[model samples]
Target: MLGRLNHVAIAVPDLEAASVIYRDTLGANLTQPQALPEHGVTVVFIDVGYTKIELLEPLGADSPIAAFLAKNPSGGMHHVCYEVPDIHAARDRLKKQGARILGDGEPKIGAHGKPVIFLHPKDFGGTLIELEQE
Candidate 1:
């Protein structure tokens, strides 16, 4: 089962520009940009007290974020991540409940170095849901 809200991810065409908006303009605390080649994204985390905001930019042409940007030139919220006590158990439960898990239905190391999985957007009211093990 899902736990607390982990972070909300926003796809951005330019990571540095977005970071400037959050860090300089908004005066938010932000983490250094980290390239996640495995996930095909360059990301930065903005500290927002209780939760965090993730800014993602495509790392490669094949990156999923690139496709997302192609559709909506102006980037937007990509997904909402929720924490889970046990990712494996959560995956099984969601599977039994007919929730479609994205990718190969396996957990991958997320930006926080925690196991995470993405669920189909259609199953969650058109919002991509990411479940991360706490």
Candidate 2:
């Protein structure tokens, strides 16, 4: 079962501006921006109760976030991350139930050193899902 609502990923076109919206407009605390060269994105986190919101802005063409935004221009929620004790067990459970995984292998490092994976929205009632073992 899920441990906690870890973070929600939002795909934004501008990381700084989006960070401001959450921090200034919404009054959420934000962390300094960080770049993940592997994923080609710059991200910031805003806490909301036990779960934090992750703002992701693509820094390159290969970024999956950019591709998501291209497909859904008015960029919205990218994924809902649920903290788990065992990501592999969660992955196996989802796969057996016919869930579509975006990546082929094990979980990869997501923002903040958390191991994460995406479950295709098509398989999750139109909501992209992320399982994080943090």
Candidate 3:
């Protein structure tokens, strides 16, 4: 089951600009940019007390973020992550409930260095859901 709202991700055409908006303009604290090659994104996390804000930029030409940017040129909310006590158990339960899991149905290391899985957007009312192990 979901534990807490982990972080909300926003795909951006320019990570620097986005970070500036959150950090300089909004006066939010941000982490240094982290390149997640496996996920095909470079991310910056903004500390917002109760929850974090993740800014994602395409890492390469084939990056999924790149594809998303292609479709939504200005970029947008990409996904929302929730913490789960056990990702495997959560995956199985969701599967049994007819929720579609994405990417081979296996957990991968996420931004927090925790096991994570993505659920299909269509299965969740057009909003992509990410489950991160707590």
Candidate 4:
């Protein structure tokens, strides 16, 4: 059900600082900061050779990223996104196998303007998993 690796998300306390580290230090080309109010994050995407790295900052105090940063003030890896040909099918398969889906178990519009869903971390070895429709 999983396709190629999509972008890996990193929750950062400061998105600009994190973008600079990737842009100046690592010599990576990054996308402009995009505020996603629905998702409660402002994101910047760094383009690597094969995949991308997403830098996320909380849009508000109630943002999930804000909660994540409270636990690790320095910021850290947030989730790994994988592409799937059909998100609905993949979701149903995972659900039948007892995998927990985040939110209302419905696909949301992601950074790439594609349908995406997040799976519970505990079900996948303590690492949050994001499934994006290809």
Candidate 5:
């Protein structure tokens, strides 16, 4: 039920520094930083062809990115997002197959203003998976 690779998310300790590398160094097109308080992150999207790279920085001490940074110290790939034609259907199918969905198992509005849900990393080869409705 997954469609295409949507975007790869990277949790960075320093958002501005990361933006510089992607923008100035790599010559990537990046969006302005946007604070997503609901998700507890400040994000910027680096456009690369059809797909994009999402840079995430912790918005507060309780942010999940903060915990991720605490373990990695520097920062690392946080998750990979895939598009889905119908998010609810995808969730039900995954659930039936015994895949664990993170959080409350409900779709939340994502950065692209689309419904999204995160699946448990352990179920997807130690890589967090995000499903976004297209």
Candidate 6:
């Protein structure tokens, strides 16, 4: 089942710019920034109660977020992440219930460094879905 609202993912052109805005304007405390080389992205986190706010900026042309930005231009909210008690179980249930996963495989380390997977928007009322488990 669901655990908590993990974080809201925002796709931006630059992680540092996003971090500055979130920190200076919104007063969000940012976590140490890191680049996920395997994923081709640089990400930063901002605390939001139990949930966090995640900013994603592609580090390479082939990154999924890069493609996402191509479609969104100025960029916008990318996905909503939900915390699950069990990732494998949640992923399995979502698939059995007809959710189309973005890729065929197991959940992997995502923006927040948590095991995560993306469910196609078609099955989630048009909102891209992200599942994460600690």
lDDT of every predicted structure (CA atoms) = 0.92, 0.83, 0.92, 0.92, 0.92, 0.83
74-110: candidate 1 lDDT, tens digit per residue: 8999999999999999999999999999999999998
Cα deviation of 92 in candidate 3 (Å)?
Answer: 0.5
Compose the digit string of candidate 2's lDDT tens values, residues 101-123: 88785889877587888888887
The residue ranges of model 1 lying beyond 4 angstroms of the native Cα positions read none
- TM-score, structure 6 vs. true: 0.89
On TM-score, who's better, 5 or 6? Answer: 5
Candidate 4: stretches off by over 4 Å: none
Determine the C-alpha RMSD for candidate 3 after optimal superposition of all C-alphas.
Answer: 0.9
Error of 2 at 85 (Å): 1.1
Per-residue lDDT of model 4, residues 29-92, tens digit only: 9999999998999999888856789999999667988888999899999999999999999999
Clashing pairs in 5: none
- Residues 1-134 of candidate 3 have per-residue lDDT tens digits of 67999899999999999888888889999999999998999999999877899999999767977877889998899999999999999999999999999989999999889999999999999999999999
Model 2's alpha-carbon lDDT is 0.83
**Per-residue error at 92 for model 5, in Å?**
0.5
TM-score of 2: 0.89
Off by over 4 Å in 6: none
Q: Which candidate do you rate higher for TM-score, 2 or 4?
A: 4
Using all chains and alpha carbons, the TM-scores for the candidates as numbered come to 0.96, 0.89, 0.96, 0.96, 0.96, 0.89
